[model samples]
Target: MKKSDFRYDLPTELIAQHPLAARSASRLLLLPPAPAPLEDRAVRDLPALLAPGDLLVFNDTRVIPARLFGRKATGGRVEVLVERVLDGNEARAQLGVSKPPAAGSELVLDDGTRVAVLGREGEFYRLRFESDEPLEKLLKRIGRMPLPPYMTREPDAADAERYQTVFARAPGAVAAPTAGLHFDEALLAALRARGVEFGHITLHVGAGTFQPMRAEEFKDHVMHSEWLNVGASLCERIRAAKARGGRVVAVGTTVVRALESSFRDGEVRPFAGDTRLFLFPGKRIRSVDALVTNFHLPESTLLMLVSAFAGYERVMAAYAHAVRERYRFFSYGDAMLVFPEREGGTDATAHDSRLH
Candidate 1:
């Protein structure tokens, strides 16, 4: 499909700058099965909307403080956003500078730490931290939260906690699974009490999650790879849920990608690797039955993925309705609950389970 197919007008004012005082206070837009009247509700109302046997597959990948500011040896200012940590003291990063540094040049951080530029790998610069400390520890000490570019402000102390989900445990992602951020401990307990089963997947969201497509034909766009680990246990639980007639709801697009990547030939299995799976129109969603996601940018891969899950026209119409209703947009924005289209449907029941 053409990238323009996903384009829609969103008032700049609707772009949320900061999260609400309470995460569960955000509004929820329900895009039920096609032809069903859409409902407007709050995030706290999710428990009542979902069935008792529903399984929510959550992305537990934790966001890392990847934004770093430093200066070159020649006194040139430079900024670094770690795309993916390579090892204990190394990473692939996007470097922003007035003048790009050559290989072998070193950046001296404001904290007095030095990072040696190894070389360029694709669009990212290969960097080696000149410290005995682990990369995660160094980042925690000096790096700032890598907030989305649209937020128009530097990270504050409050962002350190509010930007993360309560279930976040695996520490690798540069971005949080925004949908999961809406579920606080109270909401989680409520869902658990209501008998909603929970499964965990890890997809370390990279800086690439924010990259815009340069191609007009969306299929020509090469997706950026992100690390993911979907265990056997979760797959087994999902299979069990399916056998019992429960729905598998992905908490974020990342979880959907991870789960679907592990599913092949009608079997969901364990997976641990990088995936560049791009879910757009015409692609079949084999496992997930429903989705809980934040409103995405216009003409974005995220929008296309949701469009594929639901129908393209219906998803776009819902987006228009969201704009007309003055709903928030992007990360730190309100949430959306989407059910698949009925016509070009995806039925999880037909797929037999090999997740043992």
Candidate 2:
């Protein structure tokens, strides 16, 4: 498939710049099984839609305050978006500046912390902090929320909490696993009470997630590697759920990648490393049965992955419906519940009035 196959027109007004008052207040668009009517429900209605024995796998990778503003040694302004923290005093980042800094040049943070540009690692520059202070501590003190490019406003204190999920534990991701942002403590408790089991995986979202697919053919696109950990215990839980005939519901695309990357020879095993898995049409989705995700950007790899999980045509129709109904879009947007509908499914073309 060509990269343009996933293209869709999205209205600027539909892009959500800020989050709702409450996490569960965002709307939920349910893309039902083919030939069934689509359902418009609030995120709070998620529990009722899931079965008792179903397992909800979530990405627990926390969003670190990765945006840093600083000046080059020549006093020119520079912006650094941390991609991965290597140690307490070193990291890899994407630098935004008029002129790229050379090795041995020092950049000064607004808070006066100094970072020496070590060298380039592909598209990112390796940086070493000049202080003994932990990188996390410096970031917490001066880094701003790494909000999506679509959000034009500057990050505020509210974004520090709103952009992150309540269950976020491991700190590493530059971007939030946005779908998880819809679940508040109350909704999680509600699902637990209804007998839904949960498992956690970590996939530190990188700044590369925002990069657009530059290749003409979809297969030619190079996926950015991200660190992930799917432990043996989680695999065991997934097996138990499968044995009991329960659905393996992935909470976000991150969770889906983490789980599916661990699948080998019909078995999902423990895996800890970087994954470059690029899901699109024709790729077999052996791990996840259902997905809970946010509306993705047009023509993005994320959109392609969702289309691969749900039929491309059906997903396009759902996007159309979402636009017409004025459901929010993007990172802080509404949620969607989609089941797999392979491309050649008989009912792929069926239209339902409920979508209107």
Candidate 3:
């Protein structure tokens, strides 16, 4: 489909800057198909909206503090945004500077750590540092959390806590599973108290999650890859949930793509690898009954994916309603609960078990 098909007016004012005082306080726009219900409710009212047997599949990928600012040996200012950590003290990153620093050049960080430019690794720069600490530990000490470009402000103390989900564990993502941001400990507890089962999977959301579609046609776009790991235990849990006729609700598009990527011959299996699965209109959804996601930028892949799930007409109409209702949009904004048409390629019964 053409990227233009997803175009809509998103006023700059509607893009949320900071999160609400309470996560669950975010508004929820629920969209079901014809004859189904569409409710404009607060996220805190989730328990009442979902069934007791529903399985909430959450992305546990942790966002890394990948933004780092430093100066070259010649005192030129530079910023290194780590795209992917290769190993201990090794990473492929975007080097922002007045000029491209060449191989064998030295980058002196503000923390006094020296990172040497090994060479170019594809579109990213390969950097090597002399440090005994592991990559994660080194990042914690010297790197800053990479906030989205929209924030208009740098990462502060509050972001270290607010930017992460309560269930975050496996570390790799440059961006957090944003939809999961709406759920706090108290809200999760409430869901569990009402018999909602939680299942965990890993899909490290790379910078790709935020990259816009420059191409008009989605088929012309080359998706950036992100690593994911779906273990057998998670598969078993989802399968069991299906057997009992429960819904598989993905917390975000990342989880949805990861779960669908794990499918084979119309069945889900344990999967661990990088996926560049392009989700647009006409793509068949193997798993994922419902989605909980943040509103996205206009004419982007995210909007297209949600449109595919929620139906193009319904999603566009719902977005118009979201703007009219004054609901916040994007990252720290509000959320949406979308139910895909179950009768076509994706049936509620087809996803009764083994959903990603």
For lDDT, the strongest prediction is: 1
The whole-model C-alpha lDDT of candidate 3 against the native structure comes to 0.84
lDDT of 3 at 309: 77
TM-score of each: 0.96, 0.94, 0.94
Q: Which parts of model 1 have CA positions greater than 4 angstroms off?
A: 348-356
- The C-alpha stretches of model 3 lying farther than 4 A from their native spots are 35-37, 342-344, 349-356
Per-residue lDDT tens digits for candidate 2, residues 190-215, read 99998899999999999999998899
Q: What tens-digit string does per-residue lDDT give for candidate 1 at 73-149?
A: 99999999999988758999999899889999999989989999999977789999999888889999988999998
Pairs clashing within candidate 1: none
- Descending-TM-score candidate ranking: 1, 2, 3
Pick out the ten consecutive residues of candidate 3 with the lowest summed lDDT.
Answer: 347-356
Clash count of each predicted structure: 0, 0, 5
RMSD of each: 3.6, 3.5, 3.0
Q: Which ten residues in a row have the lowest lDDT in candidate 1?
A: 347-356
Model 2, residue 257: what's the lDDT? 86
